[model samples]
Target: MQRIAVLTSGGDSPGMNAAIRAVVRKAIYHGLEVIGIKRGYSGFIEADMWPMDLSSVGDIIHRGGTILRTARSEEFKTSEGRKKAYLNVQRFGIQGLVVVGGDGSFRGAEIFNSEYNLPVIGVPGTIDNDITGTEYTIGFETATNTVLDAINKIRDTATSHERTFILEVMGRESGCIALMAGLAGGAESILIPELRYSIDEVCEKLIRGYKRGKLHSIIIVAEGAGRGLDIGKQISEKTGLETKVTILGHLQRGGSPTAFDRNLASRMGSKAVEALMEGYRKHMVGIVADKIVISPLDAAFKGKRTIDLEIYNLANILSI
Candidate 1:
């Protein structure tokens, strides 16, 4: 492959800039021309591309979000849109393509590889950490740390006012953020979409805690389990505790990438370019047991990554 292009798709995650930097530098190190495709598949269709060199990526490894930017392209889902993108790939002489995103982006990459036979590699870059084949995704560490920070601060007030605080973390279909953050934050209860959680059971726990003279508590709720407001309301009504809701919203997605995230992004990015050099395509990069590995690009589309039941069970036990 003489020239390769890379793009970030779907929601941007922390350490994406590091991945971009590594992709650009690694490809240049291997004597390959690198092109930065803005806004993912949309950029591919519209030819929103520019040559990237070492200078183009210098000093961005510590940054959050993607410097190349990202967007969820609706048009890219259609056959016609894909045809347009293939035309751009041909015109730009891009022999291999690197896509950095979650499962949705990999689905596109898989189809593109099948339909056009373009060499493609995927890098998991979601905070959800819900993609299969890898234990941790790019932004999960940073986002979890962000949630921990919020919980730590909220704990101060909860302790002072003898209140119960409900923190809502972002996770539509997965509970990874809530599970990890809840455990790390020492939350009393962690509610996630993956498991059945009854509000009555939660109220009983709170009631028991109160009877035990536990005056303050923290609950981490994944958005998918229930809205923070509704959860707070139900808990307050049932337990008669002063419950407050705090929605972290998009705050978890911002800020500088953590060292773990930066390192992971760098490793994954370089490995992606190396995979292309080794004639691997329609594949995704992953880290398992701290070692870089490769998997089918569309592995995530088969099913969302299953939560580690052991970890979840341990969290439940520790909470008790």
Candidate 2:
């Protein structure tokens, strides 16, 4: 491929800038021209793109979010919109494409490629970490760390008041963040959508911890599982314990990416460029067992990334 374009779509996630930087610099290093598409497929449809160079991505490795920006394009769902995007692709003489985002973004790229015959590679970049092909998405570690830090601070207050704190973390269809943060933060209870949870059982666990002379209890709830405020009210009514709810909305989506995230983004980003260079189309670069693996982009959306039941059980077992 002589020239390629890259874009980030869907929700903004930490470490996306790192991924973008990697894609730009790696492409330039390989003597290939790079184009930055602003606002994802919307930009592609509108032809809102510009050439990128090494300096174009300077000092963005530690930054959060994408320099190229992202958006959900309702217009892009239409055949007319894809036709417009294809026109731009032809206009720019773009030979390959790199897409960084979650499942929805991958699905769009997959469709766009099939219709236009453009070589496309995907790099997973969602905080939800729900993409099936990857073991961990770009921003998952940073978001989990963000939640863990909040839990640590909340623990101090919960202990001081001897109260139950219900922390709601972002995870609409997945519980990776809540489960990981809850387990690492030593939460007394974790409620996730993937696993059916009973408020009564949650209350029982809290009451048992209190009877055992525990000064405080931390309960982590994925938003998909339940609303923190409702869960808190129910726990207070059932257990007669003072409860506080902290909804960490959007907070988990912003931050300087953690080292693990930066490294993962860099590796995945470079792999995406390499994939295109190797003439792989409609594929995604993912990490498994700390090694980079490429899979068909369809694989990312065809299945679901299930929560680790072993980790869930371990968290429950250790909470006691």
Candidate 3:
């Protein structure tokens, strides 16, 4: 392929800039021209793109969020919109494409490739880590660390006031963040959507901990499982204990990416360009067992990524 274009879609995630930098430098190293698509598929439809060089992505290896930016394009879901995108692809003489984002982004790439027969490679980049096939998505480790830090800080105050603190972390459809952070933070209880949990059970755990002379309690709740305010109120009513709620929200999505994330993004980003150049279309670059692996793009988003029940059980046992 003589030319390739790259874009970041879906929600912004840390280490995305690192991925972008890798794609540009790697493509240039291969003597191929690189185009940066702004605002994702919306940019494609509007032909909002520019040629990228080495300096175009300089000093962004540790930055969070995407340099190309991203946005949801309702129009891109329709055939007419995709046709417009394809027209731009032809206009630019693009030979292949690299998509950096999460499950939804991969799905879009898969469909676009099917219709246009364009070569496309995907690089997973979401904090949710909900994408299948890949053991871990790009921003997961950094986000988990962010949550762990917040939990540590919150625990200090919870102990000082001898109160219960319910922390709500990001995870609208997955519990990976809550489960990981809760386990690492030594939370007394963790409520996740994957496993049904009752307020009574949570309160009982808190009461048991207190009976054993525990001064404070920390509970991690995935936003998908329940709201912190609602769960906190229920626990307070049932246990007659002081309760406080802290929602980490988008705070988990920002900050300089951790070393693990930067390395992962760089590896995956370079692999994506290599995949396209190797004539592998509709495929995703993932890291498994500390090695880079490639899988069909559809495989990354075809099924749900399940929580590690073994780890969940261990967390429960250790917390008790």
Among all windows of 10 consecutive residues in model 1, the one with the lowest summed lDDT is: 298-307
**lDDT for each of the candidates?**
0.92, 0.94, 0.94
Q: Could you tell me the TM-score of candidate 3?
A: 0.99
Q: In candidate 1, list every pair of residues with a backbone clash.
A: none
Q: Which regions of candidate 1 are displaced past 4 Å?
A: none
* Candidate 1 lDDT by residue in tens digits, 225-300: 8899999999999888999999999999988999999999999999999999999988999999999999988787
lDDT of candidate 2 over 122-186, digit per residue (tens): 99999999988789999999999999999999999999999999999997879999999999999
Candidate 2 lDDT score at position 214: 96
Question: How many angstroms is residue 51 displaced in model 3 relative to the true structure, after the best TM-score fit?
Answer: 0.3
lDDT of 1 at 63: 83
- Model 2 residue pairs with clashes: none
Lowest-lDDT window of 10 residues in candidate 2? Answer: 61-70
lDDT of 2: 0.94
Q: Put the candidates in lDDT order, highest first.
A: 2, 3, 1
Q: Write the per-residue lDDT of candidate 3 for residues 72-113, one digit (tens) a residue.
A: 888988899999999999999999999998888888889999
| TM-score computed on alpha carbons, candidate 1 | 0.98
